[model samples]
Target: MKKSFLILVVLLISGMMSAQNGGNDMKKFESQLPQEGRGNVRVAYQGKAIDQMIYEFMEEQGIPGMTLAIVQAPYIPRIVGYGVTDIEKGNLAAAKTLWPIGPISQGFTAVAIMQLYEKGKLDLNDPIGKYLKEIPEPWKSISILQLMQHSSGIADYREQKAFDVSANYQPEQLVQMVATLPLAFDAGTDVKQSATNFLLLTSIIEKVAKMPYHDFVKKHQIDYLGLKQTYFGEDIPNVKQEDVTTTANVHQTFKKDKDYINPSETTTGYVEKEGKLVVAPTISPTSLKGFADIWASAENVSHWDIGLAGSVLIEKPENRDIIYKPTKLANGKTVPAMAGWQFYNHKGLMDIKGNVSGHSAFLSRFTDASELVCVTLLANKEGVDLTNLGRKIAAAFDSSKMGTGANDDLLYTYESLFSVDETMSKIEKVLKTMGIPVFAKFDHGKNAEEVGLKLRPNQVIVFGSPKVGTALMQENPSISIELPLKISVWEDKNGSVWASFPQMNLMAAEYDMESNPVIGKMQELLEKIVIKAASQY
Candidate 1:
């Protein structure tokens, strides 16, 4: 039964890709993926596909279930869900299945404040005292903009050790929890994420709009955008089959395979306990108000994001900038991130990520790219870092600018989308394809096992071009020892596979051949080889 259901899920995914990209492109996309994920991925641009990459990543991370939504500006290519959402119930995750989107909810709260600013109901520069009379005088003096920017220095109520996530604390009680604590820094002097800042913003929103915070957001954002899937944390239980809608009515990634069972329930959130996955305790919706309470399907989150990117929600680019742009501190320095978002070196790329109880959520927007791409991943596992994974997925769609080689660390290390053996095999294949001779290969793990010892998966491959090596050797005979460049592939304790090689430029410097132009060519060739082997894009 499991095997039959898995095959059915793959077919539904293929159908979804066909609907989005026509039959030819869908076939080409499938041809590039592994059997398990072939039908579940769509590539908008010409590049190595990432279906297998994502599947392997989820496996390594021990993620029970996840939903990935890829947006290419005005259109979403597809939203694919993987693994079982509820292990005990055996419910497979679907694109339409709701997930609690932790700190990503702050973006919604920020937009709500931005909307009021557009309506002339409130001014960003106005002090919070203008709206809410009950906050401490110090907090009151902080401007509305500071709160939205998270530069108000307000300490987070959630940081208190005694704070109970499962308890229903009123918003006022949450504020009072941190009322007497000193600010992390002087207001607007530095930026820090504080739930208290948004909690107070919610109060001000209620005061200015004369309605409850959730209702105002519903009327202005959710209902306006026609997002049927978004809900407050406490309201998820009431979600009905009729209330649940896929963003495009085209997603069949897991729904058909799931047989439409328990159609309206939120995905079960999980946490690692004693090195095993366990259901996480429920978080109080009231405690997360104005910060991390919203729940939505990955696709709907993409739609709301699309709305935020244009006039559909905030109405003005300047108003949107007030939230997404970096925050300016009192010291005349600007923080790299604002609200819950952190900016990246990639132009116009920013992401918001956090854990809400047992669930982890990530939302990345590459707004400034040649083609705007946004990737959203909602998963059941808590505390999994999705930044690199999200960027790699986006890079699969736009390899030239967003490729993992450029977007990741400065070290010449590539994350492999396969096991150590598979990654080493790919390296050998690339070397053969390039007509570079492989002089040696070693399996450290296998050798250790043969010697009645233990070692994790590790392998090293030595391959190089003699012509290039000879030239470098002529410059310095000592360089010959370093010739026949080798890369080590290993699986870390966490199960992530990586390929590491020496930096050619740094090696050249060591040999006092820094001025050698051929050194640059050798470096580029090595990079090309590793990328082709370890990375999907």
Candidate 2:
């Protein structure tokens, strides 16, 4: 389950490709487009078929049931559902079939906090102690923003392997589990993705709103925003039998298959387990609320997205910015991930994803200066790559800038006054500073000499952190080709030396890795090392 949550975090921060050629085309299309409704817009696209793409992806990923909503802002959302909700009963998943959203609950929690802020009930900078007086000493100093951004130094409850997922834990019990442990880092100094953050935020919401967290979210975000099919529970509220999708462990069935026929070859239907169709085990919502445990149809989730993008849920539009804006530390360094949602600044996208025992979800909102578009996907299986699949769907609606071509060149270059050899030495020193092992060093100029050909001074230093590189490769093994990071130092004809290395973000894009805290840390380290290597001082 912890691994599933980690996967969710990774999916949440993976930024989409920016629109390169679509601006003018999109503008022209928008001019001719008809308005759909209050929070909906019609978007035009010339990309490949979206429905077929989703069908193929679901088939390939063994996703039993999925519901998707594509919202072209200021227009009615296009919602679709596929496959059977129940394997044995043959019930079809539909627009109102509720699926557990897992950690996407945090996004709602963040919105609730911001709603309170809009009403002047709380300040984001206020310490948790302000609302929850029982917060421990060091934790008392941690601000609400810190908790929202996962920079409060609070230990993650999931990190405690012994903690019972099967056993229902109350909000206070969850807090107490982590409250006694020493912080992972100084508050506000670093960001670590932790459900503990949202758990505390839930408590804060209750204290500030003078009601249960669920009540606050229901009154302010769901009912107020007109999310008719959304609810905070393991089961779909007021939905009987055929209305809600049955969550299944497709991954488990896939693993157990002996013949292992490709899912695409078989018709979409029940997931058979040893000649018997299997249904997902029921779990209680009370066990996962605040951190996980929110259920909604894709359409309802899209409605929530529309509400957020339009700032209709929060009275103060500016307060809504808090959801996607990164938290800045006292030292002025900004955490790349936002307080409530993971933001890709370059692409102007906000993302939220969740993966629990039997469900996975992804929601992305693209907001450029001119338009806002949202794509939401909810699935009743664990292994589907919702982030990539959602991007594919978004591209179908706006193909102007959606392919996997490296959006930006990976290479980051810095000029230095020192000669090529000196820069190479500096590169090695910088790598050493971070304990990244130097795997190999190649002097291209020397190789040229051996080949009896003259060449300019050029050297490449290969170094990497196995812990970091291995983690990346574990996610996508193909990334091994880009692993064991390298920095090249060369002297130009003008005698100016330059050091260059691949930016981790570009590498991540190339390898299809998500932008999680580990990747963010790797990027920070690479930037620091490259700059230090090229610095004259």
**TM-score for all models, in order of appearance:** 0.67, 0.64
Candidate 1 residues lying further than 4 Å off, grouped into runs, are 1-48, 241-262, 406-537
Cα RMSD of all models vs. native, in order, equals 16.9, 16.3
lDDT of 1 by residue, 18-127 (tens): 78777676568555674331123445223445676678668866899999998887888788888877787666788788898998999888888888889999888899
Write one digit per residue (lDDT tens) for candidate 2, span 243-262.
11344423223355543322
Q: Which 10 consecutive positions of candidate 1 have the poorest summed lDDT? A: 36-45
Query: Candidate 1 clashing pairs?
Result: none
Could you give me the TM-score of model 1 versus the true structure? 0.67
Backbone-clash count (model 2): 5
The candidate that wins on TM-score is 1
Poorest lDDT segment (10 consecutive residues) of candidate 2: 261-270
Off by over 4 Å in 2: 1-47, 234-238, 242-281, 406-537
What pairs collide in candidate 2? 40-74, 40-75, 41-73, 41-74, 41-75
